[model samples]
Target: MTAQRDMKEKNPWHMSGMVALAVIGVIALVTLVAVMVIQNMPLAQKYKYGIVLDAGSSHTTVFIYEWPAEKDNNTGRAEQKHSCDVKGPGISSYVGTPWKAGQTLRECMRQAEDNIPEKRRAETPLYLGATAGMRLLHMKNSSASEEVFRAVSDTLQTFPFSYQGARILSGQEEGAYGWVTVNYLDNRLKQGLRTTGALDLGGASTQISFVPQALDGGGSPGNSVTFRLYGNDYNLYTHSFLCYGKDQALRMALAHHTQSGPMAIKDPCFHPGYAATKAYSDLYDSPCVSDRKPQGAPESFLHTGIGNFQQCQDVVRTLFNFSQCKYSRCSFNGVYQPPLQGHFGAFSAYYYTMSFFNLTDTSIPLDTVKETIARFCATPWQQVKQENPGTKLKYLVEYCFAGAYLITLLTDGYNFTAETYADIKFIHKIKGSDAGWTLGYMLNLTNMIPAEAPDTPPLPYSGYVTIVTVTVFLLLALLLLVGRTFRPSCFKRSLII
Candidate 1:
């Protein structure tokens, strides 16, 4: 009996290894079957489409995606998408012709086709968008801008693949889209954090967007949006002040500084004796001598040889008055004089600072926003200043932050507030991977180059009152600081004397 019991125990131990092997074998078999099924699935059945396009001031991009399909009957979202960039001039940039802009998209599509497998390519959908470059086409030659748009549209229609309508995203849509893309990619955009805001500084404008919670618990999945056109989308309340951009600001400054009259036509003292006349003075600061008889040497004084500088100034001034009139009186034609301070630079900086606060969803201190913008613009401004100390700089440093303009335009035009913006959140940033610069970095990470829309000569200027209001507050603060510091010093000196 004892021998029989021992035999039974040994038999159980013997089967243990076999049982383990059997389980593993079953698992392996199941995995192989699943792989085969996946391989056999149709491309459309296995993927979802997702795409994003960033049409910037300098370049445009077309992105397409095909996500992996889910197993079982349940559907799966699209896999990570492919990004293709068209390298050419932006449609709205004040440079390049229309043909160049259209070529950008075509090149991008060709590159994308090369990257995608022939078998799977048919399933992908393309998405296109145009940003500030297209918006600011008027800054350049108008005919070129139209051609650029037409080319892009025509190319999209001709492509064999399906094309979604190109999104000429509102400033708010741009902000929201960016927010969604980032957050969706990164897990950080969740729950409470979903209600966040973003600032997108482009070449010509800035955009700000925030998410808002639903009024009722049963509200829809997508968040509500608001937008404005002036300046940028950030500071809706102060959107008016930021309306003048880098180019516009330059024109205004030049206009106020120029001395108009027959003197404008006369050649001033040319440095290196290039041209004595104002019209021939070098804007880029060359050392060419004037054509004056006997070779008059260039003068070492400001405004001495810049004959063209005066004309540029006059034109700029005229434009500024025109812009100001549209802004202040809402009149297409109104009589006005330029400000006497010749401090458009200071005013521009100060106004932008205030607008930063105005654009943000939070009630953060104005100085903090000012500091951020100042830092962003300071680098380039410093370069300009260092490169040419003798010449006057055209743009204020802070005004260069196109993202601020986009933010403000979206915020004010859309009526997007902190509460509304809080719905969107930024997740993670993809660096060295923006598919927008495919022509070997020909297109850097540039934002929109704002241009006027087709048939729109000049968008009605608005928001002068905000600039004036902000300026007055700044003046008061300056006067107070001066009174506190200088008066005390002056009193002490007088008493001692």
Candidate 2:
């Protein structure tokens, strides 16, 4: 009787505690599952659009990009949605009849218009950037360049979309934007990542750009370009080698090698079995040709391939002058370039040429590149054409020369040694967008490359959720403690009564 009385007086707190914990556990379990489900749900999405025109030397390509509207500040949301290649050549090709440049773009522009939604068309910005081809046009005949620019501009303005502008992009701008495109797409420009360098090889020019530590190469001030992105400052070293593009460089080689009285030209870069006759004037008319001989009626010359990769590299090497260095160190042609550091994104012709020989995906030794080039060069031109019948005949015929030229330019001209050769990543595209300067160009023009960090809430979504979860658990625990301490007294009285 004494033990029972003592137990009743002390109160049955254990039963209340057990019952309270059971209820709390059940409620907490349900709430946890519901919270996980809600938290895991994807955010609702909205999109915005942009369009860019890449006026390359050989062709014109139209790209349409889309990104989430609300997350414009988030890096790399923009993506290529559609691409249209103009039927005709680039605008620079219409220098003779400048107005025809506008007409050539009509088909592609129409495609862009049809692809975008009618409601979004008015707000979408359309930009056109002419690369090395236009740069050469501007240099040879500024008036002609302007007429072509104006013609393309007028045509773009006729469209329903907002015509931002049509202009020739400087080599520096090309290099910088190309770098920006790579880093942006690679997500290296995000909060804690380091940016990558960009190496762009075009038909008429090539560009090298990178962020350097203290401008390493004793380069000219003109070669340095400053950028402010995401609240970080970058001092970049860039150089655009005009007329060093594969096509013009080939022209330069032919001009240098042309004998005084040869109507048929023997090109060592081609397969030995290959032969062709190109108009002599077509080779001489370009500013890249050092030949200043008075012009005559267009004469044809035989273009045959000897298929010698080493010989081709020899010809390509003549384009660079390594002798003079006004600075402590210099790339060929007295141009200053910082040492090729970190990984590099080599796109455009770099990808085209490397991919042609299947050397792009893996990092191959320099000697292996040479061996592959040799084997490809040894392949008969007829076989190459037979293998890729549907490809543009021009690209098919020039891959051998392009391969040799690419390797030579990288190794000898840019000072990229065997150790750094593997750093080059020959990429055709990033996330379906062509690997080039167009996306970065659009980003800059549209003010999407921000110089400051975006304002964010004090607590992120995950943090808020975590805090709420912890607070809820703590409150449940406190309630259990209080209920267990006080409820037993009521139990004791009720049972006794």
Output the number of the TM-score-best candidate.
2
Whole-model Cα lDDT of every candidate shown, in order: 0.38, 0.80
Against the true structure, candidate 2 has what lDDT?
Answer: 0.80
Which consecutive 10 residues in model 2 have the weakest lDDT in total? Answer: 448-457
lDDT of 1: 0.38
C-alpha TM-score for every candidate: 0.42, 0.79
